[model samples]
Target: MLSDDELLRYSRQILLKQVDIEGQLKLKGSRVLIVGLGGLGSPVALYLAAAGVGELHLADFDSVDLTNLQRQVLHDSTSVGAQKVDSAIARLSALNPLARLVPHRTAMDVDSLDAAVAAVDLVLDCTDNFSVREAVNAACVAAKKPLVSGAAIRLEGQLSVFDSRVETSPCYHCLYGHGSEAELTCSEAGVLGPVVGMLGSLQALEALKLLAGFGEPLIGRLLLVDALSSRFRELRVKRDPGCAVCGNHNG
Candidate 1:
């Protein structure tokens, strides 16, 4: 049951017919795991916290760097030397104290990652590293949790949702198997701050929809954003029967 303060604090969102008191309660009950606290993770964490998600498990092994100020909005100049998860906790707490912040400060191995995924109701892949994304997706598949994945680099962005619980849904490995060895990072390739911000915001929106049980999620679909041209396109993705991560689970 929401206290008077919660009802008032979340009044605006509750006003929406799509998200009345019931949906707000759903948001309050959900637990989410966010991997990475970089550019993409920044806005994802911000919006989800602001929207009043009950628990956010923030996982980031890196510290805030001066370069991150360009797009990682959660950290400020004061946070330059701080751990990303610590910085995120500070910022998110200020944004919404009602939202619980769980910090995973150290790097997570396969076992730890699997345990984290199993603990959360949903998972968001906001990491830039393809290898990390692959690991996260595998963990989600093994845990049978929904994964919201987003990436941005060099003015381009991609967003998708993979839910192993749904037979028709494709896991991240099904979409990008053994991602390119030449994949570049934002530091190496350079990206517009807004590009990653936009993708992260959309990822938060997708998460809200999924957690609150309203609207269609991007399952089995990939959204491509070309910031250079200010154009958006989407492609239909099919589940791969031979996908090593989720193939055996899908009929």
Candidate 2:
């Protein structure tokens, strides 16, 4: 149950018919793990923390650098040189002290990722590297967890939900063909700051809907955002029949 303070703090969100007090309670009881603290992770952290997600676990190994200020709104100039998780935690706490914002300030590896995800209900994949995305997806599939995966580069962004708990939902590997890290990257390419924010917010929305059991999630659909044209498009994406993670052929 929400305390009187919480009831007051989240009054606007709770007032939504789809997110009444009961739904608020569900959010309060949920644990969400975010696997990055960069551009893509910025708005996800802010919105989820503002919405009163009970426990938010932030995992990131990078420290605040000057270049990060352009998109990583969680940290300011003063936070440069500090741990990214530290900057994220401080800002998120200030936003909603009621929510427990736990920070894993080290780089996530297979073993650490497994342990971090064990108790969480949802995972938000905001990491920029393809390898990290694949690793996070594999772990989520192995643990049968739901993942809201998002990416942004240049002027394009994408959002999708992979619920291993659902037989038809596709994993990250399904949408992004498992391969070497030679395709897309923020390093070689440039990304608009707001593009990342837009997708991150969508990721938070997907996570909230999943936790509250309110709306149909993106599941097998890939929502694309083109900031250059301000166009929002969603493509039908189905689980691959031969997908090794959650397909029958590989199983």
CA lDDT of every candidate: 0.94, 0.89
| Candidate whose lDDT is highest | 1
The sequence of per-residue lDDT tens digits that candidate 2 reaches over residues 1-251 is: 77899999999999899999989999999999999988978899999989989999999999999988898888999999999999998898889888898889888779989888887999999998888888899889888999999989999988999988887788888888877767777767878888898899889999999998899999889998889999999899988888876675234
lDDT of 2 at 238: 82
lDDT of 1 by residue, 1-251 (tens): 99998999899999999899999999999999999999989999999999889999999999999999999999999999999999999999999999988999998999999999999999999998888889999999988999999999998999999998899999988889898968888889899999999999999999999999999999989999999999999999999999998999877
Clashing residue pairs found in predicted model 1: none
Model 2 spans with C-alpha error above 4 angstroms = 248-251
Question: In candidate 1, how many clashes are counted?
Answer: 0
The residue ranges of model 1 lying beyond 4 angstroms of the native Cα positions read: none
* CA-only RMSD, every prediction: 0.7, 1.5
lDDT of 1 at 145: 96
**In terms of TM-score, how similar is model 2 to the real structure?**
0.96
Give the 10-residue window scoring lowest on summed lDDT in candidate 2.
Answer: 242-251
